[model samples]
Target: MPDERTKYAWRKAILAARAQVSVAQHAREAAALAVAAATVAQPGNVVCAYVPMRTEPGDLAMLDALVVGGATVMLPVTGAPGPLSWARYLGPDSLRPARFGLLEPTSQALPPSTVAEASAILVPALGVDRRGVRLGRGAGYYDRSLGAADPDTKLIAVVRDDEFVDELPEEPHDRRMTWALTPGDGLQQLHV
Candidate 1:
């Protein structure tokens, strides 16, 4: 398990790197991410995904792709911040500005347990290692919310191509992802 200091250091460095992405490159990557994401969304399946804020990678395009691919999409609703609640994603127009510079669904808030209904979960990450450990923004929201997902659900870390690495620090409570979805690479199964 990684200590708090190590985790914090990694988070800082990773976020700094992500922040350096140019606006043009980011837009291209976001489009690629959307196309890649669509491939994983099965028809009639529920997909739990997040809307990208700032330079976090992937945009509403990713959510739209899932919808176009015939999957029902849900986005996280920020609440008190331990675990994220959920809301059905109607379309781009359904989003409203929320806390922490995020865009959340304007629909009814569903409990965190709603993740169990998803066949695939598109998790945002700063990085993901070869071993399947995901590095998030240090919020711990996904760690808590993902605990309620079905064990069979495909937990996928969504990142830029270079953000997928050989290793990342892991803690006991961290959830392991079985796949990584990157803009350039698309989806790849991980050996957790």
Candidate 2:
């Protein structure tokens, strides 16, 4: 496994690149991602997803698509740097600004173990690799929360097409993604 320093460098470089994407390009990608999200949203399944930050690969429409496809969506509620708490995602109107400039659901928070209810979890990542390693923003919240998910639950990392790379630094505690969803690629299975 690569050291934390290497992982930190990768995060910095990838985030810098994402920051340079044009607004038009970001919107187009987000639209395509929304369509792709619909394909994996099984009816009546609970999908744990997040409200994407401005530079992230998706938009509110992606979560909306999951709901329209008959899936119940749950979004993470930020707290101390630990396993994330979750809340049912009612709709766009249900979100309110929270810490770290993130939009979170206004509903009552569910315990971290509630992640076990999800059949699929759409994880946010700066990048993911062919071997299923995910590069997150260094918060470690997803790493902690994902441990609560059932072993069979599908972990899908949402990123831009080019962000699906050949390799990324992996630590023992970093959970592997079962699949990757990109605007151009739709869904690509990773070796987990």
Candidate 3:
């Protein structure tokens, strides 16, 4: 396990990285990049994502792109520590401020189990490494939700380019990512 200071270092690195790119620009570019890769790698119609909060990556543009691409989009809703709900992302109007300063669907009930049905899932990360180890908001939310995904689901971490690195400390029960999407690289599979 990483020491407390090392964990903070990783988080600090990501914060520094994101500050280099405009959030609006990076979101639009990264979404287009990941969507293209996901289209080729995944065949399922449903894509699940989490709404952005604080300094985490946002997928507002990504969700719009998915809809335009004729794919169904699902947004994760925070539930009990280990479970999450997935609601259809109808559009901007469908979202309202929710817990954690995030946005969520106000009119859909696709159920939390919908996460298991996704062909692809885009998650926010404070940092992630080539080994696919992700450092989230220390909530263990994704670690739990990912355990429920189908084995081949495209579990991607969206981050600024520098936050996606060559290595990160690994641990058992740490779910690996299938890819990392960034403004510069688009969709890059973890190979470190």
Candidate 4:
């Protein structure tokens, strides 16, 4: 296993690459990702997801697609950076700008434990390997919040096609993803 410093380097490199993505390419990937991600949103299912930030792989369209697909979408509400709280996503109109330049739902915030109700979680990742190791932005919010999810809940890491690699550094506390969702591959099951 690599140390935290290696993880830091990986995050920096991946983020730098993400920043260089062309605007046209980002739009194309976002459209494809929206279609691909919606496949996991079955009617009556509850999905825990996040609004992607600057240069993130997804956009609001992805969340809207999930809602249109009949899943009840819950978006993370940022606070003091432990486990994340959630709120139901009513629509694009329901969001208001919040901390970290994120758009959060204006609805009442639910406890962090509400993640346990999700059938699937669309987690943000800078990258994910075939073995399901996820490289996040080092906040540890998702890692801590995911602890409340049921063991059977599908943990899917959302990343761009090129960000899916063969290996990444992992720590004991890092939650392994069950699947990777990309614009090109859609949902590929990982070898957890």
Q: Please, what are the lDDT tens digits per residue for candidate 2 over residues 1-192?
A: 233448888888788889999999999999999999998898999999999998999899999999999999999999998999999999999999999999999999999999999999999999999999999988899999999999999899999998898889889899999999999989888987
Alpha carbon lDDT of each predicted model = 0.91, 0.93, 0.73, 0.93
Off by over 4 Å in 2: 1-5
Which regions in candidate 1 have their CA more than 4 angstroms from the true location? Answer: 1-5
Give the per-residue lDDT of model 4 (tens digit) for 1-192: 233448888788788888899999999999999999889899999999999889999899999999999999999999997999999999889999999899999999999999999999999999999999999988999999999999999999999998898889899999999999999989999999
- lDDT ranking, high to low: 2, 4, 1, 3
Better model by TM-score: candidate 1 vs candidate 3: 1
Q: Name the weakest run of 10 consecutive residues (lDDT summed) in model 1.
A: 1-10
The runs of at least 3 residues in candidate 3 whose Cα sits more than 4 Å from the true structure, single-residue gaps closed, are 1-5, 16-44
**Candidate 1 local lDDT, 1-192, one digit each (tens):** 233437677777778787889999999999999999999788999999999888898898999999999999999999887988999999999999999999999999998889999999999998899899999887899999999999999999999888798888899999999999998889999999
Candidate 4, which ten residues in sequence have the lowest lDDT sum?
1-10
Poorest 10 consecutive residues by lDDT, candidate 2: 1-10
**Candidate 4 Cα errors over 4 Å, as ranges:** 1-5
